[model samples]
Target chain A: MDTGSSPKERVVTDQDAQNITRVEELAYELKISQVMTREIRSLTPDMNMGDVLDIFRSQRVSGAPVLVNGELAGILSIEDIIRALRAVDLASPVSKYMSSQVMTIHDYDPVIEALKVFVKSNYGRLPVVDENNKLVGIITKGDITRGLLNALQHVYHEEEVIRYRASHLFEDIISDRTSLILRYRIKHGDFTHGGNASANIKRALLRLGANPQIARRCGIAIYEAEMNLIIHTNNGGTIRVEIEPHQISLEAYDDGPGIPNIQLAMQPGYSTASEEVREKGFGAGMGLVNIKRCVDDMRLESSTISGTNLRLKIFLREKDAFADVSQQGKETKK
Target chain B: MKIVELVKLVNGTVLVQGDRQDRDIKGGFGADLMSDVLASIQPDAVLLTGLCNPQVVRTAQVADVAAIVFVRGKNPPIETIRLADQEGIPLISSPYGMFELAGRLYKAGLPSFEKSVDPDCSCE
Candidate 1:
């Protein structure tokens, strides 16, 4: 049978890719102990088959591990119980009907390892043993599913809580106008932390409920400005950002070794960067140009005697506003 | 296209399988200049570059790049790999040059991530 082509052979849909990756990552990340059933019922070898059936029926469990002297000796499944009933030998001890060979999994092993064992064997459940060889729990396929769902929910909850708290910032304030200001001091030639400011800015915007497109545009714009400070200025620069309900303003400025020609610097391919800087994958002269594309307003000021200052702004449309004005308006209506 | 298929097409080796191997790459962008990449490339596109450095991962993070493919078998240093893993950005190295890798991905229907820059229209 041609068990269909590999997943790599076909283009994966966005939803499918996300779902498969989440589950696959969880399977390897979660340990068997985290998901296994801790309170498991075990049967003693000397218990009669009829008594085992009564225990199984009352507990609503189809199978259980059998212990001899507190050591795992076998597993008695529903199938074994059926065979005992077929022979009308309800009086036989569980040891006579139970499968003597048992498969066990270590509690510290990842859930994926348990899945591999389950696929290889026909057993409905595997007894989980700790490092000391003591049976700690039991695991089934259902447990894996529940474990994955809980992990997914936990991640979702964390992000949602952060977003919820941030999105409410503007709503709690009482003022004619409210704004948040963020400032960063960038050091020259600090390639190691070049984009750190921009990444944080983008994350803040996202948590504040800004749409992704707005966050991305601001992120790219600030990243370019931040790199300029690292690559060009004699000393480092300062980036200042002001965020309001309707607009965002960003400014970057540095002292001396200013742009000699602002017009030429604005051109796409113009560059004054040395060979050393070029080899490190920067100084293509597209920084200002890229920043222009992402913002609504762009300004450049320079005097070789003093310094260079660049300013950018993005205006948010009503639909794209992140502040909780609508929620405040609803409260006022009551 | 999925990142795994693109990796196979370019004869690439994964240096860091950040977050997921099956991440959906919506498009492709090839550039050695990080500024150009930050300016023009759209989000979720795979980046192809010959410059192997930690900054490449940094640029990918700021630009929301889905993955990075180091062309011409350029192995980025361990710093780059560690940064990518921390940020959950997939890193791959391809034996093929930028031109060849871009051509194959384009032929395989991976759209270009960049918007054409119009000369007449001032970006400002």
Candidate 2:
């Protein structure tokens, strides 16, 4: 149309030129942090979970940072709140259940890096920390969306972008009868004690009459998470297991350095373990991969600044519902 | 052998209602790890373990094992026994260690047939 109607070329006015320059500046400056809204209100570790719930309702923040002696001690996320309300007795203090090791960030970290943390952790929000590890501000999933909006318009690693959402995809068989919630602190490099938390979950599921399949899925996911801590994080962290009637959800966390290249870590046979772990017949680096294969829904989120926090949700299949599915063979015996 | 027959073999004292001995038994496996047993076991089989842990009995209950015989004369924890009793799985005590007891059963035609690995087994 310009070739026919216009004599030469329409000039970009001064205002349009200014607009283009502004866009360029914003394009360069819009890291993930640009979309992040800073949230600073938090709860002390000593506060009751009830207070945390109230804060969630009153402030409308997805989660709040928990402090101890004015230092970042833990986090109370919506998932934590959901687990507590569903499983824990309301009267209990947060100290009995609050997540101690948490994912955090420095305000200066590029927004792209922060997105990596959220992607690895599956947590909508992460705490911002100062050099002294004190709570400064907070970042949320909203920040991620805004950052992506400002990113270069071209699709970068479209397939690699983690997009699976549990609630959005399939309504997991959510039955509280088999569901339970257990929170515990993990110690470092204690492989012998690694399976304890998962064992406790299996026991609870049995007591709650969880279907064998659901229970087994829960066991596998939880066991992998426990072993991840022992092998990767010399200092163990924390795990919260939620047993729904049809699904078992495990949230395993550690304050260890978050995975920088989750894409590489998720690849089969990927491992960062030392020689000692390989000798123990462990750390083939199939833990998360196996967890994914066994579970119907798998989620992971992490960042380099804070440690890794993972959430795995596995639904019960029909096979585990049967009491003894393994007894059948090519030649049946009795 | 059936649970009733296994009970006879072990010379066990039936502390709970052993009526479920009528339950079908297609095979038998002996192990201690709940996940291991749960991962490979089938229902109606006789389970032999010396773990004495509550999780052992829970595993038996979940896997639908018809009976559990504690080897090495070991006794399952009280909670485990209680759970077995509730689930109607027979619980027994054997003075023989797992290797001795399993060997005897194998020799008596209860062979240690390797279970086929489930390619999609969630409990790796």
Candidate 3:
């Protein structure tokens, strides 16, 4: 998988790499207790189907767990209600309509395990139980997705701070010279602005007369590094870029919570990113690998206590610059 | 193209008309999975799908989809139509399947949803 080949020549182009990394990350092993909704909307088995429909409408939920004497008995969903509306009287007790054999999950069970249940059974929500099969909470697809949205909101907030710093700190540090240096503070969980630093780096590279290919490679490399910080690390980090006449180098150093197994993290399908991050298109476990493909040289130093530091280097030369301009000229002539 | 023109292109019936049928759609996406729509669709792109459920409307709302076109003559449930009406999203239904509708729209010069540009960007 680590063979040296151009990205375009490889079978796995970036656009269709989903099949290569179809496995779930180990990080989604969070217990349902951490993410489940405890304020459950429940119903009694004795309630009439009409009243149950009213409850569902007023509560804005399509389903609720039915209880008998404060214990889990069955699950009542909109599908069941729809079936009941067709087969039974509207005034019939919910016990007659509700699904009596409920598939349950323990609060301590991993969320991925619950996800498996959702896939297999096609149930919208599952009643969360404890050691005694007592309903403590309920986990739904909405709950999991809402958690992802909440995490994304955190990323947005970090982007605000980074934007502020870019306007204020970045302006004061730059000088008009043959060689330039720029620094950006990257925040963990800052998915919203992960690409900004790399984009800025690419712009600066282009302005400094670097070839499009070299600039694009540097951009892809740093983008991957920035994403690594946002997805993997709890503590945010900083990106330092040095652009000289012949070469460009970028260094990213985070604070702590480094990779436990760098070897596994480097694997294409191995990722620590939560399921939420994967859905948003950031954590395919391909970032580091792509970075490696883009840069001429790369180094990674990581530890659980000291955190991870990544360095990438790309060379520039007159020949590459001439080649790009000549290529553009030939295309223009055509 | 205008929404009215799009309706004609796909031989669609507008179930609930929005305020802006004259509005030009930049591109279109077709998918039945609400999650895929939520993750990938750009704002204001028309969503073509066969799954007619309340969640489809809800996903369209969350993703800021311009309008929904139910393919293969699948009319949305009353619950879904109500949600779409509440969200101010136009709902259309067509007898044509997803692929046929997409091809018609493509042939009519509408961009593929994934390949469309961000209007906010300066690039033309």
Candidate 4:
């Protein structure tokens, strides 16, 4: 019985008086293990936090399986790093806190099942072990992201996959010639959201097709802006990112009591955050210095009555100014 | 059918309104991860997805999207909508299943974004 086009059918069939059985189908099909990279990155448990950070930065991996005597010792992830960094000083060994009890998947576990596990855990990579509990391969947050990307981008052309970064959207202006201004608002007392606004803009720039170097510079500068609020302000304050297409401007403000020594605070390793924040991978006292290193122009403003505010300006030489972006893209193989 | 017409077919409310009748729609893709969306989706497009977070709108902005249609009528939080409003992207939701919505859009003459238009192959 072929119904006319105008008559809408019940897609999700259920039991009722007249059981008209129609086969249900999946919206999108899944690919086999072929399209996914299952090779899990691992490190020995005895390695220190410095090693972990090195691996994360170099491999660009979100998680690593901790191998203790060839068995699944523990799992270390970005979240774990954040926790461990907050728990101890920078020099602490990673084994002191890497999660030993990790949730993983059998080789046969469906990707959707893995997705559910990740969603529940709020963690990024999943280690794949065999029935014998031996590490075989691993799946990353990047893998899942790739899977979903392939599913949704039905119209993407080959050329689109290899695309121009600026073809997307524009980020906040940093300079008039080559930079943009970035501003972020860090809500008072909200520790979790402090550096997010700045990171969001950086990631946003990456998505919008900005050059990676520009994005990183912006991220580094704004990261300092956000951290300054968390350090001196009674409550983490506000950060604003302003981009003038060619130039970038960043401003972070806090309602807390003002900084007595602006010059000292700007020095390398000059941190006022609790020892706890330092352990968590921040409060390095090097934040302000890092910002200065990233941007071409930087400024600061502080007041005891209202709040302490810091503003930074960065100028990115135009994309045409340097023909090197395409080369980096090719190397990253994105 | 045009996205404007499809918007009427579904129960989703519009967040960021934009030109709905751009004849450039070639296909649809749905996903929750913006990172992937950022890597792919390089053409005149419409994105079908359910996640209505601020990142979704920002992803669409970075993707240079034509419109976004939320499936299963999942209206996102208000903050997400506010962000979308700022981005000038339109959102549509439908009571229809993602499968039905996809099939309907395909059958009504919209081609898959990746669907080869070369008539020599003859899949059509």
Candidate 5:
């Protein structure tokens, strides 16, 4: 009856249209080119399905546009490829499998318009065309998501830099007595949280906009001392952290069996860790040596009764002083 | 060389289905050590390994390896396959050992990272 109603066209619901309008309004200032990938990889109609798969794998792309006579012909997507792989032979020509009626967007069009097409058709990507209807670019959900993430990160880093600048502005006013103290208790044999204290200090220093090299050196020194406390001590320990404008000092004090031979303990390949510890990717016998190399000044005090007290000082006054000291320490270790 | 050609060359079986079986493999790297794989293999290179642990798949994902072919007829565990699928990497299991599989692929025109002449190549 009535020739099956002339194969009724799929209708776009009112809600879907409304959602697209909102998307357009929100992205009114953004253009398709802003988020589209310019270097598009496309497929040819004559290429066999096997060739298509080869292109997909070598290029690490899930789908690609199909071009004919230097014009936009269609799109061959991953979903279509998967379906074809299951139903058709890999030797079939891609033209027989490509979606000829491809939905495309202009490169200069508003991003919101592309958003509408995407929501209505539920497509993963859209081919971008120029005025004369030639494929110029391709845009995927990944590109849009990455663009938004980069924009958000840029804004966040700007805010952090501004905040850091303001803090330095106040430092000049209170130049005489500004200091930050951080403390953590280290439990003996608590390998589960071995480097927690040092990690926290590193995070704090980074947030405060300290030079990355200085912060890294301080972190390394604290970590080595913390490992010593956990691996070699019996009665646990404490770490006191002090951060001044020009210097960072870390002290680890433990009430456990101390090192009997300080010189031997300072050697690069000397370790007293059990066999079980060595199997866990640690206790390489380079802990103290590495600590000494990372810091500007290091002091170790140990005795059988008083346990071990280690102080690591890193200077941040001269930008290159820490690096120079690191160089010297490394040569000495060699 | 195409991955399908590799499967035929080594008499291997494709375990987990991936996007493109026809993908071209630029080179092959054979190793059982994850660290060596990480330090040496380049992106889009196929890894030939006998290790079937989840870490193998994880390493491939991090290094952007195109595919992994398990040698010695070893099948990867389900967890490893799941990870590989999630990462969009293909998994192949070869009946041949690493040395033979590598030799077969090399003979089939797949280049190695070392850039040496194929043993059969008669050089002056």
Candidate 6:
């Protein structure tokens, strides 16, 4: 796996990162046995080189493992055949053309190990053997490429199916007014999970067929409110989002220790967060301001005894609407 | 500018290389406040912050930030790296301070992603 250069030393571009990461992961996870060709095309050591050329041409294989009584002995490649041709020894025995220093790979070893061996040894193929050293199969670079492509295609199909199902949620249901409500309970001072709810809401909106701009607006607004709950509440709070075809309503409310001055609290750079909270790069008094910027409607109600409640709404334009309102009206009439 | 080029400009080390390293950065936003980042940053912009925590990655995810650069060569915790990787947001650490990195990026033709706050808006 060590390619004489650490990851930090490599100049990784954004495109390379996305591509290499997936291929790298697949290489480490896939086993040699899983991607190896199980059928053996073995060549006996005593076979004539002329016969070997006939087998290679018919099988369309560049190489094969040389075996004696089903026991691994050596590998004969196209290069060796070329050498035999150059020497005018087509009738020579297979052992004369085969390379006895065969590099074999374990059946259970990760495909990445084979990749490393290939890079280091510049071998075109390797014989696969089980733990008992019995020849099980043969693996080529082409086999690994095909295996990775199959795995990637499988994942792509699954994700597309899920997206199709989720995007058609409103269309598949019959209701007078269809709305999906998502609720999340935020823990106070839990900085680690602060934006989790917002992330989920954004993902849900995207899955539900909302456009990227709309999902982003909702994400930013909800994120600010969620963070406020985590940073300023006595017992944390709950964030509830009711998503309709035309509008999205988001509400975050806490129990106690409410804001004393609503106007001041709404002001940018006005925060009552403790010194400790400020050290963590939050409590900058911009959460409410940011939420207001992202939402079309914003309402804040609070008291020292009753805590605070913030509600936000964004009305989707016709082009950005998640579902057809006219279709819903017809369904309601029926 | 390409993120790899930007990284080279600041002599930064990539902690988590996200899926899109070749993504062209439209602009840059330098802020430690997550809310400011959420409010001002436009999509495809690189977020440069002094804060090295998981929330920064969360904030980037919400804002659709192209990447995050930690100034002063500060490496975030493992959890932060994991979150950034999962979200497909690249994370880099620079040996320079926030001001220097911002200036260098700005000099390198990266525009600012910040939207100026409207003074008369009552939403605040």
RMSD of each: 6.6, 29.5, 19.7, 28.8, 18.9, 5.2
- Model 5: TM-score for chain B: 0.86
Winner on lDDT between 1 and 6 is 6
Model 3 lDDT per residue over A168-250, tens place: 33224433323458999989886544566776787566555556657666766676687677777777899999865446789
Report how far off residue B49 is in candidate 2 (Å): 3.0
Candidate 4 - chain A - TM:
0.45
Q: Which 10 residues in a row give candidate 2 chain A its minimum summed lDDT? A: A162-171
* Model 6 pairs in collision: A14-B20, A14-B21, A14-B22, A15-B22, A266-B124
The best candidate by lDDT is 6
lDDT of each: 0.85, 0.63, 0.70, 0.60, 0.71, 0.86
Give the poorly placed runs of model 5, Cα more than 4 Å off: A1-175, A319-334, B1-124
lDDT of 3 by residue, B1-124 (tens): 7788877777776776654667668889997644345334555688998877665665555445678898987766665665566556788877778888888888778787653323222101
Q: Which CAPRI category fits model 5?
A: incorrect
Candidates arranged by TM-score, highest first:
6, 1, 5, 2, 3, 4
Q: Can you write out model 4's per-residue Cα lDDT over A242-316, one digit (the tens) per residue?
A: 754445677777886887788997765576777656443456566666566656777777767777777776665
Q: What's the true lDDT of residue A96 in model 2?
A: 65
Q: Which residue pairs clash in candidate 3?
A: none
Error of 5 at A329 (Å): 29
Q: Quote the TM-score that chain A achieves in each candidate.
A: 0.73, 0.41, 0.44, 0.45, 0.50, 0.84
Measured against the true structure, the TM-scores of the candidates, in listed sequence, are 0.75, 0.38, 0.37, 0.36, 0.41, 0.86
Let me know the TM-score candidate 5 reaches against the reference structure. Answer: 0.41
Error of 1 at B6 (Å): 3.1
For candidate 4, give the lDDT of residue A42: 78
